[model samples]
Target: MNAAVLALLLCLASAATYATAAVAQERLARREATAEGGNRSLLRTGAWWASAGLNAAAALLHAAALRYGPLTLVQPLGALTLVAAVPMGARAAGRRVASGEWRGTLLTLAGLGLLLLPASGPAPEETLSFSQVLVVAAASALAIGVLASRRAARSGLRHAAASGLASAVASALTQTVAVSAGRGGELLSARVIGVALLVLTFAMGGLLLSQTAYQGGLGAPLAVVNIVNPLAAAAIGIALLGERLQGGPAGVALAAAGALAAARGVLLLTRTAAQGAAPLPQARARDRSDLVGVKPAPAPESATVS
Candidate 1:
């Protein structure tokens, strides 16, 4: 088969794997949230480890796709994870897919397609120097620290954003290591080893952050991570790696519109998720009564208790 076809197949497989892994992780997060003590060791959870394994498999598939396809092709296809995740998550939760979730997912996907489609040619082949790597690492750490701070209100969304930034930085470092290795540079050199170590550190950090994000719900948090990952990676490519967007002024305009659309979609998804997560009025009243040491009023005879 041709390289493009192979790449397409690999990308699809990767997207499916990613979707499944997301669902598993989100379920595990929910379990951990509701479990007593809330301090259950992730290492003791079989599903948590299983989800991590699936993520590793998906990464391998994605890397293989890049081998046979250009970034312009492979990167946009990664957005399919969000597309697949919505329905998969609904199915996992035994609920119907909501209309707003579908709309938000589609909008996010369209915007990502537009945002990634402007790179008309291959990016420059380059590797980050040790100093450049340090700078990038510091910047990513600061961003993640702020977003994942305890003061953040939308804990899930903030954690998801932090995860996205961490994953993006890790991708950049991985690219550096890949380029260096591909060019027959010294793999065991101090610089290369240090870069490799940073890659692992960020990758693991992102995984933990994403697990936390999933505790809120699937659609909105996953959308945030998926949306931020590529945009941040593209920004890194443009600013630090000598990459350029195509079509000059027109491309810039298109990318800006895409970014706006994606942001709006994320907002819609976040609102929808929040609405779904709100407590029922009856439940809220009952909880309030319980708080004051009063019993809730009895329900009507015909009313369902649940």
Candidate 2:
């Protein structure tokens, strides 16, 4: 097969794998949330570890896709994870996919496609200095701290956004290291080693944060992560890597519109998820009352007579 076809297949496979892993992680999260004492020990759970393994496999598939295809093509296809996830999640929960979720997923994908399709080709070969890497790391940490603060109402969305930022920074750093190594720079130098360590730290941080994010629900949080990941990475490319969007002002306008659309989609998704979740306590309470054989008191005789 041609490179493009191979890349497309690989990307699709990667999306499916990611969706499956997300379902597994969300299941684990839900169990932890409802469990007594809330052990929250994901590391000890075989399913969590299995999900992590799936994520690693998906990453390998995605890497192979990138090797065969350009970023503009591969990156957008990555959004298909949300598409695959919605139905998969619903099926796993023993429910039909909600219309709102379908709408939200499509809107998110459309917006993302608009946002990414206008991108110019590969970025210039670039490397961040050690100091620059430190600066980037600090900024990412600050952003994550702000989003992941306890005051956040939507814990899943907040954590997903933070995870996206961390993953983006990690991607930027990985690109830097790769570019430097490709150009025959010192791969074993102290600076390189430091950046490599930062990459690992951010990557793992993103993973753990995502695991937490899945506790709320699958569709919205996953969409947020996928949306934020590419946008943040693009921002880094523009600000630090000398990258620019094509078509100048027109391109900028298009990107802005796309951003707005993507935001709307995320809002719709979160609202729907929130609405769905709002009655859980009452439902569980009713279930508990039934279990205990509780019954409502009858009306007074006067009231019944009236």
lDDT of 2 by residue, 3-114 (tens): 6788789989988998898888776777667654443565766777899899878866765665555444556677888988888877666466778888888889889878
Determine which window of 10 residues in candidate 2 has minimal summed lDDT. Answer: 278-287
- Return the lDDT, model 2, position 13: 98
Instruction: Evaluate model 2: give its TM-score.
Output: 0.81
Model 2 / residue 73 / CA error / Å? 6.2
- Cα lDDT of candidate 1 equals 0.78
Candidate with best TM-score:
1
Which residue pairs collide in model 1, if any? none
Model 1 TM-score, 2 decimals: 0.84
lDDT of 1 at 24: 86
Q: What's the residue-level lDDT of 128 in candidate 2?
A: 75
TM-score of each: 0.84, 0.81
Q: Model 1: per-residue lDDT, tens digit, 131-182?
A: 9999999999998999988887356999999998897787777777766676
